[model samples]
Target: MDKEFTPRIAAILCQWCSYTGADLAGTSRLQYPTSIIAMKVMCSSRVDPVLLLKAYLSGSDGVLLGGCHPGDCHYEVGNYHTRRRFAILKAVFDTLGLESARLKLSWISASEGPKFAQVANDYTEEIKKMGENPSKKKMFL
Candidate 1:
């Protein structure tokens, strides 16, 4: 088993919930992998599937989509929109032979800061096991 750790991860968090949770994580001083690069959006629905494509095309090893846990969207069902978009996005990744494991979509509320940290750590570990994204080399080379 050839295993190496590449910790570059792009964390796209909804301004409503996940972002708040991330803030709580900081206030609580919970330490997860610092590999996460956070990008905030007013709504998770605002995260276009194109961004995910662009991230992997650039240099991101993983793209983590976090939202308000389905119906809890502050924008009212914004998370639903995100969920549907990612469903198709994941399918596209599969069709292109890009490792779908590199993309993650999760529902975490503002109160669940510890959960947010755990998710970040868990996803990071998962992607680390998968190694670098194949799309990175395929697109660049």
Candidate 2:
């Protein structure tokens, strides 16, 4: 049998920070996996837990919430709120016995093109380690 190496990842990027970084990644021509489906939000703090779960249910093997650095939210303190929200959401995902590695939160500033590339690359590798999510087994075509 041959091993498969492609991965499907969902990236939820805050428009202010992480999304811009991703854009920079594009303009810089830094190559990363094309598998990511980027969902742009105004702020990471705005990422509701329900939305995260919905993505999993929708077939993405992994979810990455990208946000601004602490104290850097254009919306003023949005990232601070996200810090609190991510903690609780992670707890719930754990209680549900989902792979913790399936969810990730990253802060990538608009100027950090390399950072965005690295994060995407690293996350792709992490989900690969986790292998196919068991929930995927139940997904119907």
Candidate 3:
């Protein structure tokens, strides 16, 4: 891939799981795309739909949300809420003429460093094929 054409991915990760897993990936030196710009949150449920939209509008080619697996959330039902929210968000994306494939949700445990790296690589490649986010074509107020 051309260095200048690399996709820019904005990721929101739950601190208890996904963030820890990413930290582990870093400490372990697991190779993954550097295209990911990760932000840590207390829970996946805290990732507001508007935040994700803003990311794409701000020029991110893709947005990734990572959290604990179902029934494994540190906040009990947090991931469940995230699941529901993402479902709604996907619908909104479709209604807005956006490609739902540009957004991804993954469950990563604190012990899953390799998984985190793999997810990062896979999502980056997927975004590359999809090209830039169409939302960037419009100006956001």
41-79 per-residue lDDT for model 2 (tens digits): 988988886788777777678889999898889998988
lDDT of each: 0.87, 0.85, 0.91
Give per-residue CA lDDT, model 3, range 16-133, as digits (tens).
9999999999999999998999999999999987888778778789999999999999989999999999999999989977788988999999999999999999999888888877
- Candidate with best TM-score: 3
TM-score of each: 0.92, 0.91, 0.92
The C-alpha stretches of model 1 lying farther than 4 A from their native spots are 1-4, 139-141
Candidate achieving higher lDDT, 2 or 3: 3
* Model 3 misplaced stretches (Cα beyond 4 Å): 1-3, 139-141
Residue 29's C-alpha lDDT in candidate 1? 96
**Model 2: CA > 4 A from native:** 139-141
Better of 1 and 3 by TM-score: 3
